[model samples]
Target: MKTAAILNKNQLSKDDITHLLMLQDEHEIELLYKKADEVRKKYCGDEVHLRGIIEFSNYCEQDCLYCGLRKSNNKLKRYRMSVDEILSSAKAIHDTGIRTIVLQSGEDIYFGSEEIRDIIKSIKTKFNTAVTLSLGERSFEDYKMWKDAGADRYLLKHETANVKLYSMYHQAQSLRDRIGHLLYLKKLGYQIGSGNLIGLPFQTIEDIAEDLLLCRELDVDMASISPFIPSPYTPYKHHQSPALTDTLKTIASARIVLKDAHIPATAALSALDEKGRERGLRVGANVVMPNFTPAPYKAYYEIYPNKYLTTEDPVKRTLRITAMIESLGRRISASQGDSLKQKVLA
Candidate 1:
């Protein structure tokens, strides 16, 4: 099939996306990425927004098969930051003039409602910056307490929108429960963020299309999509990872489908392709999450294989990504307001 013909098929159905994924032609994928990049540039412009991420805890209760820190993995070292420690980290991030701090962790049982609330309160009071929580699923009361404590956004990736495939990865977790939590978060007036992995052991392109459709249906404020990277400790270690070209195509298609959601040029995307981050920005991704975790704990913050481990040095990763954005004719803003919302809406 001609590249132009494939690109012109604007309303990509499940079958179409599936067909594109199956095609192993490198030339076709590159052509699709270039076209998608052009479209992304037209809509989003040549600028990247940076979000500083702090992986607060690695202690998780869930046993997700693909995650390195799953509860079943007893070999993994687990750690949780005290409220004071968290506040100190937030203060350092604030000094960098990065207004957004993403407080992410695996679903840990150690921090109950009160502890989580205290952490959120401390960050909000001390730094006076936007707080985003990605601490796995929580109850309505817990979410409300955090929101009331001044959390502005929440990210909970659905992992995969396909129910059966979701079951394959998450044996103990329920798809209904995950979806309900996201919907509940939305109802609680939190800026909801949900997404899926691009390629998994059994994921089809139709599954990816369904994920995009679900994001639109939910009216999500942020959509984080990353290509599946196999972990050595995980069950699917030997499975082939998604091709870099396929990953970029998914990002481009996502930009076209969910034009108003904050799409991140994920570290996984960048890890897969040499210029994946730059290409993603050109193809509709507007947010880049630079790590802000302290150096001593950097190696322990692995969610997937070969993840970009950021140092305690606040501006190291941020500055590098900023320069890359500049090289691509884009600028990274020091001000951390919700520029994502503004750009998506514009």
Candidate 2:
């Protein structure tokens, strides 16, 4: 099938998505990326929103098969940032002129609902920034409390859309329940971000197509298309990482499909290719998350091995990322970079 024909369509079918993912010819793949770039410029413009991410805690309760932070991974050292320390990191992110602060950690219930609420309230009160919580799944009450406490966004990656695959990757977890959390967060008026891991063991191209379609179905405000990087001591430790080509293709396909959604060129992309961030921006990505997780604690939050810029100084890394974004002719977004879907809803 001609790639241009599929790219020209206003709406894409699962079959069209699958075919685009399977693009192999060098010129054909370039064409796919060009179309994605055009669509990205049309919807998101040239501003690359930088979201400073702080991986506050490494402790997790679930035993996921592919994550280094899984509870069963005794080889990993666990640590949690105190409330004061978390605020310190948020202040650092704020000082750097980043308008969005993402507080990400494993599903650690130790920081109970009240503590989480307090953290959200403190950040909002002190910083002129948007707080995005990526603390994994929690009760509906907790979600509402945090939202009421001024949390602006919630990120819960579905991991995979296939029910059985989701179960296999996350033991004792149900894909249905994960999607339920995403929907509830959306209904609660928090802009939601969700996406899939490309090239997992036993995953197929068709499954990736469905992943993008699921993002559209959920009407997510942000979609992250990241490659699966194997973590040491995990079940898939020896498994090979996804090809950079496939990862880029997924990003391009996602941009073509979820045009108005915020798509971030994740740090995992850089771990795959030296120029991954620049490559992503050239394709369709409009956001780049800079890690602000402070030292000692940052090193231990390894969901995967050798995360890009895991230990770099926050200021230095931000400077380098800014230069790269500028080199691509993209400007840094100064606003909170809220949900693009807001205008449509309003």
Candidates' lDDT values, in order? 0.78, 0.92
Predicted candidate 1 versus true structure: per-residue lDDT over 1-346, tens digit per residue: 6555757876666666665556567777666667666655655665566778888899888888888888777767778877777777787778877788999888986889889888888888778688899999888899999999989889999988899888879998888889999999988888989988877988888888888888878878888989888777778778777877677677767766666577898888866766777777766687888777775665776777664444436776667777788887777665654524446323
Cα displacement (angstroms), candidate 2, residue 119, comes to 0.7
RMSD in order of candidates? 2.5, 1.7
Top-TM-score structure, candidate number:
2
Which 10 residues in a row give candidate 2 its minimum summed lDDT? 337-346
Model 1 ranges off by over 4 Å:
1-11, 19-31, 307-312, 334-346
Provide the clash count, candidate 1.
1
> For this target, which candidate reaches the highest lDDT against the unseen true structure?
2
Model 2 residue 329 CA deviation (Å) reads: 0.4
List TM-score per model, in order: 0.90, 0.98
- Report lDDT (Cα) of residue 331, candidate 1: 77
